[model samples]
Target: MRNGLSTFWDGRGFDLLLVGIPLAFLIAISGSALVYNVVMSFQEVGMFTLGSFVRPFAGLKNYAEVLSDPQTWPILGNTAIFVVGSLSGQFIVGFALALFFGLKFPGSTYLRGLFLVSWVMPGLVTGALWSWLLAGDFGVVNFFLRSLGIINENIFWRSDPAFALWSVVIANIWFGTSFNMILLSVGLASIPEDLYEAASLDGANVFQRFFTITLPMMRSTIGALLSLGLIFTLQQFDLFAALTDGGPNNASNVAQYWAWQLSFREYDFARGATVSVMMIIVVIAAALFYVRSTRHEVRG
Candidate 1:
């Protein structure tokens, strides 16, 4: 018994133990939950059956019903807009800030570090802060717009249907921009300085060198960043909960928030699970893309 124990510790058993622990944890926790959720999506789950593992088999009825609902398409549209708007705004602003900081100006590092304050804050907190800022009556956003002569009156950002979705989009941009900046900064830093020097010697202008060298080199990083952005944006529920709650007549409604509303608020668990399953599919695709991009970057 003592020899066996010693062999187990000294041999491949230790390596297997390390790998097996996390694998077991993943299977026990995340894998089981995901499987249960997927199964629930295909079953008829009600208040009465919520606690039970066995429920009436629903087949594809949940998916069919969720798809047929009028709100589904519009909410999905809103989600697309949110994802695109947030990702675009975050990437553009982040890339610009990264380039600016890459110049290595004095205090640039300190200033860059300061921007991480937004990324470090909780999503709900950021949403609440934005809620105050976007208030129609006494919000700072309205005040600033009025000061800039950009508008004649307060915009009612959170309540008005026309702008409610966009209000969240703006806040999301601010919340995620710093993360994008930090990652993009790392990408920029990874680039070889010799390429830039050689390009300069070849009489390439700033724009030429940027287009030919910087962009090509950062392609993998951008792909990974965008994929991660897709995943994060899809999972963004806190901001919606805090700011809009999918309210103002569901104008700002997205899949994640709608799923919660259906399951918890409306007590339609099957439909909610259906929405979640759909989102899980999308998220899995994005995760795959992120993995592929990372692999390509590592190989490069």
Candidate 2:
């Protein structure tokens, strides 16, 4: 018995144990929860049936109902706008910041570190801060616009239907831009200085080097960043909850917050689960793309 135990500890059993524990935990916890959610999406889940795994089979009725809702497409459109606007603003600002810091001037490292305050702050806190910043009457944003003569009167960013969605988008961009900048900075640092020197010697201009060398070399990094950004933006809920609450006539409503409202607020569990299932499909596609991009990078 002693020898057998010793062999197990010293041999393949150790490796199996290391791998199996996490696998078992994942299957028992995350996997089970995911499976339960998916199953609930196809079942008639309600307050009474919520505790039980077995319920009346709904087939696709829940999905059909969710899709048939009048506000569904508009909410989805808002989500699309939020996601695209946030990602574009975050990426452009982040990449530009990354390039600026790459110059390695005085206090550049410290300045870059300061930008990480946004990344470390809790989402709710960030949302609250931005909410104050975007207030109509006494907000700094409106003050700046007024000072610049951009508008005649204060714009209600959170309450106005026209700007409610964009208010959250701006907050999201600020919240996430730091993360994007950090990742992009890492990618930029991994690039060889020799390449830039060679390109300069060959008479390549700044834009030429960026387009030819920087972009191609950073393809995998960009792909991974965008995929991760998609998942994160889809999951974003705190900003919406704090800043708008999908309010002012559901103007800023998004899929994630809408799913929550359907589930907990309205007590419509099955339809909420259906919406979640749809989002899960999108996240899965993004994950697959991230994996493929990293694999291609490894091969190259």
Cα error, candidate 2, residue 70 (Å): 1.2
Per-model C-alpha lDDT, please? 0.94, 0.95
| TM-score against native, each model | 0.95, 0.94
User: What are the per-residue Cα lDDT tens digits for candidate 1 across 23-70?
Assistant: 999999999999989999999998889998779999999999998999
Quote the lDDT for 220 in model 1: 89
Residue pairs of candidate 1 with colliding backbone atoms? none
lDDT of 1 at 230: 97
lDDT of 2 by residue, 21-76 (tens): 99999999999889988999999998888888779999999989989999999999
Candidate 2 global Cα RMSD: 2.4
Off by over 4 Å in 1: 1-16
Clashes of 1: 0
